[model samples]
Target: MKPTLAPFPATRLRRTRRTPGLRDLVRETTLTPGDFIWPVFVRDGEGIEEPVASMPGVMRRSVDKVVEAAVEAHALGIPAICLFPYTDPSKRTEDCAEAWNPNNLSNTATRAIKAAVPDIAVMTDVALDPYSDTGHDGFIENGEIVNDRTVEALVKQAMSQAEAGADIIGPSDMMDGRIGAMRTALEQGGFRNVLLLSYAAKYASAFYGPFRDAVGASGALKGDKKTYQMDPANSDEAMRLIERDLSEGADMIMVKPGMPYLDICRRAKDMFGAPTFAYQVSGEYAMLAGAAQNGWIDGDRSMLESLMAFKRAGCDGVLTYFAPAAAKLLNG
Candidate 1:
């Protein structure tokens, strides 16, 4: 039953806030290690862990090291690990054929992680940006981002991830009808159990600069992603996108650039009552980590607070760079 408050004098609200035990008892929202989906960068190499300068503590792990990171994350009580490939510029092509190569860095990493840590769920990014020479999620047609062609390419990408045994296929490309297309393909391709975690309300925010650099897209991108990604100023539009994705066979929904879009996450969860997630994007991590390194904020406290905020905002889980760190603290 929900707690009820009496009149000001009778209630004595300060009484509950007075003690640590009392505060714990009344706390409505809880954060846990299991609530994290750690996002890791994958590259092609052996035993390599390259630090991302933009995101201090974050590293781009080669396929072998990514498996190790998966095992560590599983031991930390994180339930899932999301993979994003840091593709080499040389491999990028206009056709983006490497995206569904089955032996690409992302697919190789997925197979390695599942083989080593099959108990932990494996999530793969299903977008062409990492392999696209154009550095756009969708194909470019006469200076415009084309939707239908992108959806077809995304289906191929999703199929490869599923074939590699990815438990969750995250379509971060915001092309309309791609969810339904992927769903139909997954069903027919005999990977009926794979989950579609749609990046339903992804925004074209300045907060993605660090991510672009990590994925080697900073120099390749021709223009802004605003044509495909949602506008930062629209809240109601987020609702529309979330509902549309869910209706199109998405098992879960996510709002990207997490902290800044908690309202969207909250609304999505409340309205759809589906599995809702948020991406604590690279730029968000940079801001907090940078400030803490500069002694402007308490790193551990700020990280914990920011994560708890997501839980209170109704996120089922968060895709965060600080997952292992935050999970360790929560476990302690």
Candidate 2:
């Protein structure tokens, strides 16, 4: 006898695609400029817009240029802008005190943006890599990346950012107990409303190579981040980290180097149901931009689709290099 279930022919999946209205009606996730937190690189200079060779179409802007970019991003409806400084080699000290210096590049940019366009939320990266002489995310002593000492420094860095008028403190160093320390510091320092977006599920992946290049860390890095950053081979560890960070008072949690780790993002969102975010890191952006430059892909479509994937993965927002371009496209 023939099959009793007759191949389910009545359920035409393509029915949703027959019209734009139908497609919109059934769309599971939607992305907009408001869902993006643009990660910008700040360099110390005047009239500078240096292109990061590893990350095509991205640049390290001077304080003035950052103000301009902030204004543009604000007008484009991008709610936040994250600052990562390309610290000068001379400022890279073993102590990484420059990370908390009031005159540092990130602080300077934050102040300038606040002065010029206070409406745009200024997010600051609280990591030591940019200022560490050893180019590690934490202090290295006797060939070991110490934990408690690094958390202390991170608290200082987070407090410094908050004092500089940072609207969000993003601790990307992956050091243990840093979130609780920063949270306590912020509370004591009278920055009770400043948001903390912990890089909770960061993995030690080769995907950060281009990010290191963008921040001028690739050349200075002495060893791998395997000691602190989560291993790429593990997923349960990510959940543990997320829970720990949440318990430590993180206002939001992030999964770094986004695309390959969408599963982690999904799990974090499902488990915690907190304000979850993702970072579309430099390497992913480079690959997409490179392919588009070579005419191998439709850059615009691919960029938009890549961002939409984060929403589909249940992310509340994304830190992406494509922020400005994607925002302009959405606005248009």
Candidate 3:
């Protein structure tokens, strides 16, 4: 039943907005540390916290340092951490075999984090771009990024992450049939409890430039990923991808380049009523942080407001680089 509103003169909406406590009481959305999935970049080294020049205040950390960061995040009440590898150039290859190597930078970081911070969920990226010499998420054939062959490699990568104690497998490769394939492999390998968070509506957008640089793929990429990733123009296609991935056994779905695709996020959540998430990718972070650094906007307020926008847009959580800082502010 809907409540009937009083006459305009009798109603005073601003009364609720008159004070902090009143505004809190009337607030429809809330942001918290628990609503964040922190994205951490891993590199192969010791005692290294190399800064990503494109993304201010974000670093590519070594395995031991990643473990320390995971422990800190767990203490801050952040539920999960997502791992992205900054693969060494020597390891990048046409086959991308290093993507599934048990000793790979991502896997090593996953194992270390699990050992150190058992309570925090560990999520791993299932894509080949970090390890592919061609800088494609899938194998290239006749100058095209092929789908089926790429899924095979993704399955291997997912299985390796499961073996390394990753609690969530995030397949960001955007290849068809990967969700089902990875689900089958996980079940067969007795990793039935692991969750699959599919990057179902990832777009072929210009906003991923900073991420490519952070992962050291910018120089290696042969061409754009328009063939496999979704087009930014199609909203209906995003719904279709979400449906397909959920039907194939994804426990959750994500929309990438979050702020720009908020309508898609809201639609996905409204249509599927599932655990929906979005990635505030590197470029988005850069824009906000850069603006704030130049005294254009209040940084802390903007960060919290941006995260709250995700909740208002129907996201259950957001994969963000600002997780730690936002969490600290929320805690305070």
Candidate 4:
């Protein structure tokens, strides 16, 4: 039984809009530091804080610096920090053995952060692109990306991260059967408590240009990732992927390149009722920051508004470069 709406002026919709207190009281969505997952870039060397030119104000910090950042993020009430390694070309290999190395840059950073800030949740990216000479998320065979073989590699990567004290194993590699494989491996290895956050609807989009450059993969990438990643035009495909990952063993799921595919995020949340998140990827950050730097828009306002859109669209949290800034604003 739906209630009938009063006609015209009697409804008085503007009554709530007229006052800030009323607006705050009636707000449908809220943003906070706890709802943010800061994505940090890690590299080798000590005391290094190299700036990523493509993503202004974002730096590739060394392991020690990353630990410090984790401590600060914890103090700010941000629940998690995700690690993406900027692997050197010398470490890149055909088999991507370095990706599963327990002492690699990413794994080392994970250990350092966990040791320093025991209460902060550290998430690790489980993809071979950072260590692959071919710079594809999965293994390539005969100029084609193979599926099952890639899942085998990703499982090893996930297990290695779990060994390094990763609270969340984020498989950004969009390979089939990887989630089930990783889950079984974790259960057998006494890591049943570790969370698996699958990148279920990662799309092959032009927006990843800045990310490729940030991870130093632009030159190493042999070709596009269309075969493994989802097509940008298909929404039904995203739902299917989300369902498959959840059934396989994903504790949580995500949609990549968030703003453009918010429909996918909302759909995933509605259909699955699981913990749904979105990655506000590098290119999206660059666009807003670039415009703000040029005085074209109020950067702070735009940042909060953009993040709030994720909440309104049914996201549990957002992985954003704007985490620290937005968190500070929300705190203030």
Can you write out model 2's per-residue Cα lDDT over 91-198, one digit (the tens) per residue?
999999999998898988999999999999999998899999889999988999999999898898888889899999999999999999988888988999999999
Full-model lDDT for every candidate: 0.93, 0.93, 0.94, 0.93
**Model 4 global lDDT (CA atoms, 0 to 1):** 0.93
Backbone steric clashes in candidate 3, count? 0
lDDT of 3 by residue, 1-332 (tens): 99897667587788999999999898999898999999999988899999999899999999999999999999999999999999999999999999999999998999889888899999999999999999999998888889999999999999999999999999999999999999999999999999999999999988888889999999988768899998899999999999999999999999998999999999999999999999998989999998998999999999999999999999999999999999999999
In candidate 2, which residue ranges exceed 4 Å CA deviation? Answer: 5-8
Candidate 3 differs from the real structure by a C-alpha RMSD in angstroms, to one decimal, of: 3.3
Candidate 1 error regions (>4 Å): 1-10
Which numbered prediction scores highest in TM-score against the true structure? 2
Error of 1 at 324 (Å): 0.3
What TM-score, to 2 decimals, does candidate 3 have? 0.97
Candidate 4 vs. truth: CA RMSD? 3.0
Q: How close is every model to the real structure, measured as TM-score?
A: 0.97, 0.98, 0.97, 0.97
For candidate 4, the TM-score is 0.97
Pull out the clashing pairs in model 3: none
